[model samples]
Target: MNVILRRLGMALLILFLAGPAYAQIDTAAREAYLVDATTGTVLLDKDGERAMPPASMSKIMTVYAVLDRIRQGRLSLEYTLPVSERAWRMGGSKMFVEIGDDIRVEDLLRGVIVQSGNDACVVLAEGLSGSEEAFANELNRLADDIGLRDSAFRNATGWPAEGHVMSARDLAHLAHRLITDFPDHYHYYSELEFTWNDIRQSNRNPLLYRNVGADGLKTGHTEEAGYGLTASAVQNDRRLILVVTGLESQRQRAEEAERLMRWGFREFENFELFEAGAMIEEADVWLGASSTVPLVAQNDVLVTMRHAAREEMTAKVVYDGPIAAPLQAGQQIATLRIEGPGIAGHEVPLVAGVDVPPAGYFQRIYQKARYLLLERQ
Candidate 1:
């Protein structure tokens, strides 16, 4: 009877401890995910890993590849390329690149982004790779290099193709990588409007104006692909990447993206686990010159969670203790894991805060004796 009572009491205590940690995540999209750009931690996801048509969001890779070429000095934004008839005939969303007209690479980028111009994409692809097919091969190669396993590119313009597809998680990964890896050229993704041949068009990504902190990204729509968006925003020095795919309408895509962004920014707080090289705690030593050695973090540790449950968080550090001396600085020594309500726990590797050289011969013998004695403690 006493054992039963104790078990029931522990169950009640666990529920009481966890009750306040739950927050309703109101994200509405067929395929969606949110990730911390700095930490690469997935905060929310629904069918995010499943492959789906990215529609025009595929252009994100197209632009990324082009920017890479420009950075390598193989291409220049000021370079001019003649518009071909094939580029002019591109079916959907055009910057009116007419045959025989020459346009600068810089202006073509604005056209592709602001107007969702298939024509502009073709011109850029042909200009950079000498052909659209070659440019797409480059896109796929780069995607593999960047860890986008489920993404494949068939064309530069993101026009519907049989095998051209990407998962929501992969899209977010690509967007986050672009911003973090190439900040110098990332500003171009935020351009709101562009003019070509005296006609102006606005970018389709609605979150740029509707959501605070929303900076830049891309949007796409096709009868078969539906409406999709890959958006990102920064708040309190933390940047978040969001991907939403296959919405029924443009209005729904905008509304849902804003809602998801708001839910993430307003509800969650990011916690720093440890500062880079900051000592976590000291490990006990036996017969060494120093009685204790410091355990540190190799990198900044961070996690995101619901703001109200911050007090409930707990951290546990695990490592092989009484480490043999001659430990080098920056060597991985342990792991720090954090757990709290409503958040899945995450681990960050801990490292030796400083070098610890072995003791002299006499000291080594003494340490062995100490270990034998301490085993009883």
Candidate 2:
């Protein structure tokens, strides 16, 4: 009886411990979120979707739309934009571009990114769309397409306006999209120094220099909005995005951003879900040149999880099975899902490893004949 009671007590104790194990969730951040940029996993969130004044950080969307135009061949970086009186009159964070002066698009971008130049933003807007109002419309359109549901833009320069608001989660999502979608153009945000017409300025994101792995992002401030920063850092191959808004001072913004980044690095680790071009699994090919084709991920798949729970994770590949032939090498074919306790599941796209052309009529006939002959043997 004593032994049986001890065994039952052990079972009850195990259940008690297991119950809390499943309840352990990462709910850090007072008004913030940490996401896996590649996989879109919400690692942590606190009022993440609530809208608030973004201040100058709204310029990130403006830059994204401009860069998109450049990539689409609608505009060139070398194209010269004429500054207007309206552009020069922008109040906060001026690049000081004089009216009637011609500035290259590249230079203006540097001014806007490194110096947070409202003047530069206006110049780009007018240069691209012939008016800032029209450009603001385009910004709103782009925001809609990119899933920034809570954001709206009333001006191209993110000047104080009634509808110019974005949530911290939205800004972090935008920052991630900027970095991942346009790595070539994203370097402009991290530029520490930029000089225009003999005026030198530096990026306002202070954590860039002080934090170990801090890089590209933006800063904002106004009497109404207070000081805020959207900061990102990569450490030990794991990247984290942090957005802090409504702080008292620039120093406080920087300190809090760094603190949050450190907490992310210390508490969580990135787990690779799939490797680029690596075959995740095989897909059956019917009536094709090959009997089976391999599905792969176009890029490395990764997710952030708490460090202590790394060993308890499982990765599963999910996709339509036995995909038809004539498959293109880069076609998306599947998704890799990573599951673990205390961490949300993350899914990333898997692509075809190699092109597989459909078998010709004659090839199919030959295959059938060979199969029949082999069976007869």
lDDT of 1 by residue, 28-117 (tens): 577889887876667678888898889889988888887788888988889899998899899988899889988888888878767888
State every prediction's TM-score relative to the real structure. 0.89, 0.75
Off by over 4 Å in 2: 1-30, 273-301, 311-337, 348-377
lDDT, each prediction: 0.79, 0.76
Top candidate (TM-score): 1
Model 1, position 228, has a per-residue lDDT of 92
Residue 127, model 2: lDDT of 87
- Candidate 2 lDDT by residue in tens digits, 1-377: 01111120111000110111222233223366666564565655667888888888888888999889888899888999999999998888988899899999999888888999999999999988889889999998999888897898888777888978889889998999888888898888778898887888888888889855877788988887788888888876667787877788777777777776787678666666556777656666656789777767777766555655535555656655446678888888666665666545656667778889989999888867876786698
As a TM-score, model 2 comes out at 0.75
Backbone clashes in model 1, listed as residue pairs = none
lDDT of 2 at 66: 84
Question: On a 0 to 100 scale, what is the lDDT of residue 219 in model 2?
Answer: 91
> Which regions of candidate 1 fall more than 4 Å away from where they truly are?
1-27, 284-288, 311-313, 340-345
User: How far off is residue 140 in model 2, in Å?
Assistant: 0.9
